[model samples]
Target: MQLLTTYMVRSQQKFATIFLISRGFTFQTMDFQGKYHIHCLMQLDLKFSLSFNSFTGNVPADLGSLRNLTKVTFSYNQLQTRPDGLSFVTDLTNCTKLQLLDFGHNKFKGEIPASIANFTNTLHILLLGSNQITGNIPPEIENLNGLQLLTIYNNSISGEIPYGIGKLRNLMDLSLWGNRISGPIPSSLGNATQLLKVQLQENHLEGNIPLSLGQCRQLLLLALSDNNLNDTIPKEVIGLSSLCIIFDVARNFLTGPLPLEVGNMSKIVDVDLSNNRLTGEIPTTLSQCLMLQYLDMAGNLFEGGIPPSLRTLNGLQYLNLSRNRLSGQIPIYFKNFTMLEMLDLSFNSLEGEVPQEGIFIDTKRISIIGNKELCGGIKELGLPACKVHNTKKRRKLPKLKVSITVTVLFFIMLTCLIVVVYWRRKSATRPSTALPTEERFLKVSYAELRQATDEFSPSNLIGQGSHSSVYRGILDGNQLVAVKVLNLRQKGALKSFLAECEALRNIRHRNLVNIITVCSSIDFTGAEFKALIYDLMQNGSLEQWLHSSENQSDMPKLTLIQRLDIAIDVAFALEYLHHHCQTSIIHGDLKPSNVLLDHDMVAHVCDFGLARFLCGSTNLDASQCQASSSGLKGTIGYIAPEYGLGSTSSLLGDMYSFGILLLETFTGITPTDVMFKDKWTLHQFVKAALLEGTKILDPSLLSSEHLAGINGGQSGDVDKVRLEEGVAAVLRIGVLCSEELPVERMDMVNALSELCAVREKFLRHGM
Candidate 1:
């Protein structure tokens, strides 16, 4: 190893070519002493990988001596461009067979040299992201016609994206977010028919979204948020059928009615057009989007009632129409939105009594705030009681009319008697709880999961939390799933497994983790193999976003809107479990790690290991609710203060945990962060920061310059004190919900209401 580092023994090992790669393990920086021992192996024509290492210092120009190199990956290292700058890139042009150049997540800086055009024609991917690289994308880059992916996001690259980028006819992915790039999207981009994902958000780009982009029929993800783009969204762009992943155009100056062509994107899973000037009624044609799951049209000028056709979307999970001019009664057919979890209709001119059916039964699941004319929901919403007027004027009825009325009443009585008798007999024979309520997507045996997860291999493991080790697996139907194998040996693990089954059996909500099936069969060893299966979340858990260091460079940090959405999602899930379900459930352990994000970043609350039934009523005491279970109710840092006094878990405890979660999400500091000592806590830290307007806010939230305009800087811009007020209001709710005294803490409905109020301000003024 020493000789390999120094090149002193290159004569003895002239055949050495490839370097060992480090992944999933940390390594200390080892000085290269400016050596290039691998140059002797130029005849071997081997690939070199020094990725995921801690190597530091500038790229040595001596590396150019390896003319036979075909792939060079120095990703996730501290390597940078030499002080002479980008000269190393000029040297790499000598490697005639080079096909891949990956220098992502490094300290590389300075302009990409025009000499990049000299790279071998075989080069297909240029991954130079997460660096300090600056300067315009040179038009010479178009020479790499064979390039498929070019990602330089999260860099200091600026100036208009070279129109030549569209000339890369074979390009499949183009990501240039988190830069200062300005100028309209090139119409020539339509020429790249193979493009799959295009993310140009968080830039200074202005002008209309080019209609030519619709020509890229293979596009799956199109994100153009946090830009200065203005004008009406073209109908051509809205009709793309292949945009099935996500279509986000939020935080722009878009105007005009939503195109009816939106219905053509039937396969898309998520759509966001919030914070725009769009007007006119929502297109009823949206009903044609059968696969839509998440829809957000908040912060727009849309008027008129929500189209009744929206009820036809059985798979829809989230819907937000808040902060709009939408007026009219809430649609009665909303009761048929069976899978809908969260609905926000706040800050609208909607009228009429709020419905008390389906998701509407939970005041926490629906928001009618700012609609003063709305009346009557569940008692918790505080809407006025609906009025009834009984004024009967009996006119002398004709003999024929009286005779018909009497006959109809006689038959109604006879039918009622028969139904009562039949129902009584049926009720005596079977219990209501015996009926299956939760939908099962599939049923698979333990053996199938074993095969799917390679006999429970360690490499298949995706998570190990809440007494269950979750493994990634693909079933026979090509369905991706997360198989959570229980650790029954742990204390309370068996009980938790049973509790989860009971809790999920009769409950279904879109924001809650959707369970596919459960396995209770014996393993190959004849011991029990208890496991729960769910849809595999592509983004993993919120904890991974908040703290995971393994892939921080690769994963995008959560934005303010994303954080708000996730917080709202968790609240909806909690509201459903606590107040909407047939039997109230207390998610005893509510924390960031338990919240999972699907592919579209929609949150799904998971991990029911500490979940339990709140049998009696909403006001049940902790001991009464936990009589059937034993052991601690929550994780150490998130456990309610009352729980430490030997009290059993309650819904209020879950609210407390949720409050902490909200605080952590914004501050990017967990309750157990080392900064808290003595009497200080996460609450105290935030409380102090709120007063001082200190920069305790997460840096990721401040990355976009536009936020300063939305968030109302300390100078107090009048167009948006509402934004600052909303921020303070969110922190206040966090404090109030997590108060030490349970009696003083707000209920889930009130907490939800406060959040909606804050969210309304954010949407209406802060965008």
Candidate 2:
């Protein structure tokens, strides 16, 4: 390590590209000392990138001594400052040739210094996300007329978005989510015709969305969910046909009818207008969006039956018209949506027989619970049967036909028994991700488990947590399994084990991590031992996909649609836990690492150590999500804001964690990222980005071949637009669900409805 450090110090002049990505190196930490940043470093046009490294300490000012430095990529590091408040950025102004500056995803504390404006006009892209920086963005930031991408997302930035930002004619992307910035959005941003993505959700921004945005002919994605923005949506803003990705403005006070001109966004993928005051009939012109996969208008005042033109959106995966005033028979054409997975029309005044075909075949996939007057075609719906009708054309059935049908039934019954037996046998295979929910309890000793994991060898260890260590093992029959051994020495390890046992005792779902058995015995040294054995997921955890390192070169990056599917699967598991179980269960911790993917890439929610059971028929909405606990539970960042105030665990808290998971999955940003510390949060960062129309996309989603598969077989540009829009749509769902206020947050039911809508198009295209 010392040798490498010395080599780096001596060869600073020769170092042009310091790309240190994906090594997953766990050696001792290395410090990039101030001595290495001297003027002798570069002779000409140097591009230094030390991303994804463990380098520590403050960024030295001497880095500016390199007059020829053009690009600096210092992301994903431990570099921090001591009350410096981003003063490191001040030194970089000396590099007049600098064009790109990225210090994102680091532990840098402090503000975006005023010197940011002093950088040469050649500077285009500036990234400072996921930091502990605080303060308002300087208005002089517009001095960099050549700026194209400016992202300061997930920080504690305050004050208004700069009014002078409109001066940058070449600007394309702007992301500034999760800040305390308040005031109206600058309408001058409309002049930046090159703008493509704008994300500014989760802030205190108010006033109407600007009509000038309509002038940005190249605009594709726009998100402004979870803020105080009021007034009706501008028709000029909503009518842009170039909006190929997402158009989100949910959780605002936007009043009045949804404009019929919304039909102009023909190439859009996801559109969310939920939790607003928008009224009037559902627009029939919405059928123009042949590529639409997700459409959410829930919590609005739209009245009428499901539009007939919507039948053309057969590619939809989710359609939510819940909490509305719509009244009429549920459309039968809904049965034609072969790709649809969730259809929620709950809390509406609709009355008619519910269709039993397509997505309605499974009661778990659809919700119509609050429509008391509706009758059902399926008995599981618990609705009254359709009224018996006597038609004038009643005819007698032939005896020969009845006899032939009876014969067929007899043959079918005989065939069903064989199929059932085969299914049971196949389901018993231990290597699969899913285990039989009901089985004879198996008795296993500590010695037997020790043998499966080679006597608990470190080499066999798969994962380690605060109170448990997981090891991969093989049973007597070559059955692969994961063994989570409890850490008895930890403070609450015993309680965690007990809680997990209680949570998993009576509930099971296909999307949930499956446990096989348990071992409570004594180890060789007479020490107490307890471990849980679960079916091993062949594809590993969702963390491996979203945050892949260089060691993961063999692992293909998950496409936007693929990530959407995984997120949907996790949401389904949580929905089953919080609402479908005999007794409501809350998985207190819901970060990406806890989500395991099977060989089929299906996500399974796991780690029930912090699970809570909400016993009773208490209504979650009325309860304000209060559940008693002795202390705070759940991982930081993902935990609900109320939990930090000694509020304990609740159904709402789980929803918050799920919301963070949704954001992380789509945007590839962790809930506890360095940028979301103190008063700043992941929800706000994403929200602000949506509101300000900034670019908050995870670049990994559009790199290499991932873009090609995002839009099915569409053009390259279309692929990018649709993929980004889909991501923004899912990110908005996350934003609403993870809002600071429990009441403002979308419940599990509504979130699932929106997610089901987001993943359909990709699934239909076989993504």
Candidate 3:
């Protein structure tokens, strides 16, 4: 036997390697007794293979000496782990070129080692399923950036999925089902945009199925049944038009109406929404999924007659709509379902004469039991005959009531027309401003501004600045405008008014706020009046989104992608000012409050009250701004460090302001927060997080997903790794631009380019 083993090892080693790598469980030996001796083989990088063998004992720890080993499999064996856990798996670190390893379907018992992450980046597939392996999945597993698949199912492994796993950019499949894994499915999973299949069913995972998963436009199958998951399924998931395979989330605590967007998944084959606590009627829009088969929506609270549109799914098989509140006659279309193998509509309120043809001819293939109202299929089934109801006629509305309704609608339209005609004539009769120019689109008087803004009412006020207050107003032309009314009582109000006018007088860009018209006239009381008019932003300011004030709670949140676009918009505005414009204009204040969003959610950089044009190299014109002083021209917490020391407002100073703006926007933490006390600035706070490897991002950024075009599917960013890297780049730019020394800062041109690249990579492939 020893001679035969020696000859086989020498002559067939290379051929066996090819066969072992090509197949699984092909070397079973029922007559195998005691431990199959692995040490007796001529050891030249043993690419081992095994099957359902009785080979008992610890996996040899000497595989470290077989440095050239590439593929190894010992599935369905009796191999067990030593008392110290899978410590031998650590020895494979020496085999740096190793690619694939499988120990599944074995008797191996112990915790997976964190050191397994130390394996070569080429190691793409690792299977440890059907074992007694236990303990938490180590967070260090994120280091395996090249891993395409990781299957550790049917094990006793426990604990939360590490948040860092979102960094696996190449990961395509992750199967951790039938384990003891608990805690929330990481929203970061959405960042793995390449992910195709995820099997996490029959686990203890809880929390909402992240809406971010909608970003996986390439996702095919998702199985998440038998978990502690609860929450209304995100409509984005239903709108995943690419989810053409099975969509199973049964046996969960999910609630709320399934969104009508479910119709978007028209090509899905198998759908199982059974045993959930979902409410509301089955969406009739579900008729759009025509390729459906093996549909199981049993044990839900669905009501209403099944939509007749479902008759289109002619290939349906194995349908189970049992234990629901569904009512109405069973559709006759069931008799035509030639491919249907099983049909269970039990415990429902179905009432009809069941068809005698098709699957209904055999009681064994279908179950209509517990539905008391159902009757008459076949004599062998022994059901009572169904009864028909008498028909009734419908009533019509009174002619007198209909005539009165029409008269009221006519008067309402007539009144609106009269009001519109009066306003248009009034607008034509008297122009508002003391001086109206063709350059401006709209011209309005003090009274017109006052009237449009509800008599300068407090309710119409949208923003407040140091020298001005902005009020939302609608012109006679039905156009929305933001009226920046200057406070003559303030110290620098006059200079700020001139600075803003001069700064905006020549430059024009889409991202820059558009000036509609200015009003420089007196009121009825004969007091001074000066106001700047610009396009009214429908979505409000970035400040409201980041840190919403008390009165504005309904403001929609900004996702990572939206914020990135806003950053780029602001960058474009800044780039045009510093390079594209006739002269370099410094936006002295670049805080969140100064950035507004138009109706389309496109960002526009606003407020140029502190803007200054560079006359030459290092000098900011004296008349342009009173910015070179300890008091500073811009708001505190955003002013460049040099500004506090009485330094001139150069282009570099603007870079510093933009730097602080980026940090505040991404972190969602104000520069003036109490945490930045004791000489600890926001710059240092973010710099520390990056340098220390303790990554931090806005809580909203992490929780949100990339839901583009599906009911305003907007979240932070789509890909987590790209998100992490993109954020790191932005923060690094912030640090460099906000550096104490002006020369150390990143230039605006380069910064703009860097920002554009970040957007390109992060948003290249999301919904």
Candidate 4:
């Protein structure tokens, strides 16, 4: 290591790139005595990135002498300096070509140097987050007119945000959250029309939100929550159509009614205005936010009835209106809110009967703890049964008896007609068959299904399962479909059929197979017949594409990008079912065969027969989900190890399965492959291979044709590095997801984020 350092110091001109990422080596503390030779390298124009390393001691002060330096990232290191000093920052002013500078997640203390204004106007990004930087942002920062992103989060910086920041027309992202900043937001921020994301949450900012902020027509995310802001939300700000990700102003002192134009954010996914002083009714206009998935207005002063139009939010999953002044009955139409998962209406003045349908069936999911007038929910809610208040009307019942006698005489004649019809049905001996109470499927007859499948011929058969056979067919003479016919001869066939109908009818997603129709009626043999029809997947199941006979010659191999896309699609599907659905659905059997791909290779999760809904969305504290299922809920190779220990099912279990699927996709090896024997499981196999580089990756992804010239040129090696990095990221995520302990596995959301980051890096690195 000492020799390498000496060589780097001597060959300064040739040292163009300095990368020591993830080497896990620690450096000794050294002050450099202000004589570091790196100052000589400044003339050569270098690009240095030492992220994810264990570098200690103060950063080299001479680094600022590199005028030709373009980028410097030193995040996630152990670097530190004197508590009240940032001398190196002042030195960096000489680097006229510097466009990116990041020093986040380190112990950089003291006030940010005023010399920050000396940075070149070409600088586009600056990240100083997760540090001990103090004092207010220097007004002189406005000098960097070309700045695009500025993040200084998790700092002790104080004072009002400078209005001069608005002068930077090129600014697009500005985040200063988790700071001690105070005072009202500057109205001049509206001048920065290119701003797309603004986060000022967790600050001491006070007063009303600036109305001029509405002029940022391109803003996508606005988070100003956890502040001292007061007054009503601006109507124009609420009406910004470009705000799509989230608009959070919760935990503030804001008052007055929400603007009626709140419905204008059609593309927004989350709206949080909770823990505020806001009053008046929830705007019925909120129903117009068709894409809303989360809405929280709890701990407010909102009054009047819960808007009935809220039932129209078909995509809403989380709704919190608790601890408010809301009165009147809970909207009866709330029973139609099929997508609602967590509904908190507790601590309110709401009166009358609570609807006993939809999410209301789960006591843990729907809270009404403080609403004394609420009654008639499930017995578990401990509310009294609803009763009539008008007892005086009982005395008038005697006068109606004479009229009731006449009505009885008329009913006797009707009974004679029913008896004649009943005798005819008894002679024919027709057995009454009960059908499952399906929710949202086209009700079809047995004859229609038979005709669609050509009388259930073997030629139409596409796939066969334990208790059902799927056949490809055409419905209504044009709609291509896949009909799953159940065989009652199996012991649990009928139960599986009902379970699938109940599961699929209650949930829907683009990644989930669409149930086109269902047929439950008597067949030609006078016996019960049941089947479920789905939109046909032209490309068939992923299982066929992975392991089918290669001799067919027409089958297309899945490239690395395609596999990554499929992994993302499956992860999203599981995220929706496990976290975003009205109730968590445990996909007991997640396997390659259960994953269908359309003509575009977009994956759709299928076969909910083994699926079951968990009572609570995230109440996996004790495995209540697993206890709800009669037996284990997944296939052999992908099943979580916890399931074998008699533990209950949980979202973590599904994550385990997804992890196995990702590993299998990248390695082209299944858990049940013949080579996996004894203690050499797929997880251990892949984990070991990751230690050996890309030896376990699919050959088709890293063919010699693409890798041969990779050793010839600098750009070739860069592409090769990116490819390896992408593969390493995938393998790392897979190993983490398939950990032995369920709690050790990565959450689906975090996994998705890492996958996205890796993809972005691959694109940016030109791979």
Q: What is the TM-score of each candidate against the true structure?
A: 0.49, 0.49, 0.48, 0.50
lDDT of 4 at 79: 76
The per-residue C-alpha lDDT of model 1 at residue 426 equals 81
TM-score, prediction 1: 0.49
lDDT of 1 by residue, 595-633 (tens): 999979999999887787775665445664656445556
Better of 1 and 4 by TM-score: 4
- RMSD (CA, Å), candidate 2 to true, equals 28.9
Q: How many clashing pairs per prediction, in order?
A: 0, 33, 9, 4
For model 3, the superposed segments whose C-alpha errors exceed 4 Å read 1-34, 37-46, 388-767
Return the lDDT, model 3, position 564.
Answer: 83
For model 4, residues 253-358, the per-residue Cα lDDT tens digits are 9999998667668679999999999998886557657789999999999999886556557688899999999999988776777888899999999999988888
Off by more than 4 A, model 4: 1-40, 82-84, 336-339, 388-767
Query: Candidate 3 residues 1-767, lDDT tens each?
Result: 11112122221122122232221222333222465444432234445565545556777776666666777787776788877778878877777777888889887888888898887487888899999988999898999977988999999989999998888988899999999999999999999988889899989999999998887877878899999999998887766766778889999999988886676676789889999987788765576576788799999998988766567567898899999998998888888899999999999998978889998998899998988888888998789987766566556669998899999999999999998798679768753432324544566799989866757766457789779999876666245678999998999898889889978876789999999878899978899999998988867888889997543332457877788888889888998999877667888888888999987889999999888887563434664444433256788788888888878778898898889889888889888998988889998899899899777778766654433342345433434565677778878887887887899999988988888887787666452
Residue 84, candidate 1: alpha-carbon lDDT: 86
CA lDDT, every model vs. true structure: 0.80, 0.80, 0.79, 0.80
lDDT of 2: 0.80
CA shift at 50, candidate 1, in angstroms? 2.1
For 479-595, candidate 2 gives per-residue lDDT tens digits of 667999999999999989988986786677899988888888889999999999898886789998888764343356787767878888988898899878766887889988999
- The candidate scoring highest on TM-score is 4
Model 3 Cα shift for residue 703 (angstroms)? 40
